[model samples]
Target: MAQSWQRSYADMKVRDLEFMVGERVLLKVSPMNGVMRFGKKGKLSPRYIGSFEIVKSIGEVLYQLALPSGLSCVHPVFHISILKKYHQGGAHVIQWDSMLLDQKLTFEEVTILDRPIQNSRSKDIASVKV
Candidate 1:
């Protein structure tokens, strides 16, 4: 009776997430709470970032993902604990071709809305609107 009660208690709290092949999911970035990594500042970093496709289910709790070229150095297989099911929504769509990013991941300003002007005191107020 005690064993059955324990099993029921565990089932009430533990969730089993089974991800299908070709489904998109987010990868968790496990970082030290106060450390900075991957260009994300300390305490303000994103806990999970991705919409990577699941290539296959390696096992019941493991999966292989089709990561983008940017993450080629990372291992493709990940434990289910670090994966989050991604829900597709219109707001989550990205227009990759429409982005104007260059080699350094910076986009050039197409036009300047306003130009800087010097005040009467000869101080140049450099304010830019892009």
Candidate 2:
């Protein structure tokens, strides 16, 4: 019975989310300092600040994200409403060497340095001799 249940769940197709951990995504974020005139001038800026890795899921509404610039931050676990996927060209067209050069940080670097500040602090203290 357990096996059957698991199989059914696995067969279900999850909606392809626009943003995922380790995915290079472009966010249509609004600048915090922009002037709002009559609410009609609100604009979204398509700024690509490298890639972000999702660290943890805070319930179903929030996610902890690690930015490429080595900053850890949380973002609203927005439904597909506010996120868009950045599609790199097809595999057939892009070469592996070029793709590697474009990446600013390796996966290991992101995994190690992009953790929450609290976590990083604890690790740092452990490394230092008391």
Candidate 3:
């Protein structure tokens, strides 16, 4: 006798993406500043500080992120647009103090230094002229 009703889809194809609880992932946000705040002004300040590990998935969309500061929060369903593969490289391991001391540093430090100047410019633009 022949077997009846063979499975159409392969088992490998049906497997869910395996993400561990403590897997480090980079949380991405738009440059619009208030996008993550969900329409609230002056409350949300979004920037790429560093990578956060996945604490757990609340459901299908929402995920709990464990920040480096040892704080965790569950909200914000991060789509693929905001997610990028966290590349482990020399750039990620360089200490702030060491970078400041090193004469030859990576390009990432340029942005870190530039941010303060950018903030100052914004403050000047927002200030009322006497």
Candidate 4:
């Protein structure tokens, strides 16, 4: 049927991510609807929060992560759509203890160590040097 073909077409783009016990995975940070609105520069903000270890796969599309003690209030299980396998050599490892994440999994403003203001086209643009 047309609906079956449509489902297959959609499924083609989706990867069946499988995680085993003790494997590490990154938890995607989806923006909260009410409190913090993702502004104009859409892709500027960070996407994933962890490199957190996967405790186990609860179901075909659900995973349990080994979250830190600081995130005791947060739920452990997450859908596969919001999870990505953590490659050992993929990117920089985050210090989970130092990061401040709210209940909505939104991170606080990153500290700007050095910011230089540059004037361009009658506008002052502040460049952050992290």
Candidate 5:
């Protein structure tokens, strides 16, 4: 039957990832249609953010994580489908402390180079360094 064939095709692509307590994982987030995320927009936006520690497993497919204070507004529990098991890596380490976020989750621009300002517009341009 068509339904049986469809199910078989879907099963081939499904991932069976398991998670244990005290393990670190990355949370998956979908980017908005027109909004920017992590300095990238559209397809360029990051698929996952933050490396949170799993505090507890609620059920077979749900988990609770130890999220940072900045993400307190979000719920602690999440479905396993939205979590990706994190592997230790050098490039994966991010300096989150230096990132400044506003209520809308947009990053604040930081000046990269110092310049002697002669006009008020120069200050505004400095903010656009990034």
Candidate 6:
């Protein structure tokens, strides 16, 4: 009975969402995953990529996306928590670009935007901005 009550409490905090086939959604990329590729001093990196089309909804909380050729190695299916339904004219936007991903799903950094040096008591640290 306690387990059932706990399950219900957890479910109550989660929003019930369902995506339809052909809908566009943004896929989230966490800092730990994407930060290494772009040397941005680990700051100002985008947390999500794409307004990719939803190919199919897998059960209730997972959806398959039509990812680009560069991300072919990545599994198309993702959990609902990592996805946000694309809203028309919303602030979150990206100029769609072809990104190359390795087998490990890490992307190549295209350009270096800026580089700044940080001075510490022990040593001077150089940080690359992408």
lDDT (0 to 1) per candidate: 0.68, 0.39, 0.42, 0.74, 0.71, 0.74
Candidates' TM-scores? 0.55, 0.30, 0.35, 0.68, 0.67, 0.62
Candidate 6 off by > 4 Å: 1-13, 31-37, 41-43, 96-98, 103-105, 108-130
Runs of candidate 2 with Cα error greater than 4 angstroms are 1-20, 31-49, 69-81, 90-130
Compared with the true structure, the alpha-carbon lDDT of candidate 2 equals: 0.39
Candidate 3 minimal-lDDT segment of 10 residues: 99-108
Task: Compare candidates 1 and 4 on lDDT and give the better one.
Answer: 4
* Candidates ranked, most accurate by TM-score first: 4, 5, 6, 1, 3, 2
lDDT (10s digit) by residue, model 3, range 13-77: 55444455677666543334434322223544333334666777666646666643222232434
Candidate RMSDs in order: 8.6, 19.7, 14.4, 4.2, 6.5, 4.7
Clashing pairs in 3: none
TM-score of 4: 0.68
After superposition of all CA atoms, the RMSD between model 1 and the true structure is 8.6
Candidate 2 per-residue lDDT, tens place, 39-117, comes to 2243432223333446555555445555433222323343343345556653322122221211221211112333333
- Which stretches of candidate 3 lie above 4 Å from their native place? 1-18, 29-48, 69-81, 90-130
Pairs with backbone N, CA or C atoms under 3 Å apart (clashes), candidate 2: none
Residue pairs of candidate 6 with colliding backbone atoms:
none
The sequence of per-residue lDDT tens digits that candidate 6 reaches over residues 1-77 is 99999999999898877889999998776424435543333556555678899998888888989988767777888
Model 4 misplacement above 4 A? 1-5, 31-41, 90-93, 110-130
What is the per-residue lDDT of model 1 for residues 45-73, given as tens digits with 9 covering 90 to 100? 44566677999998799999996666565
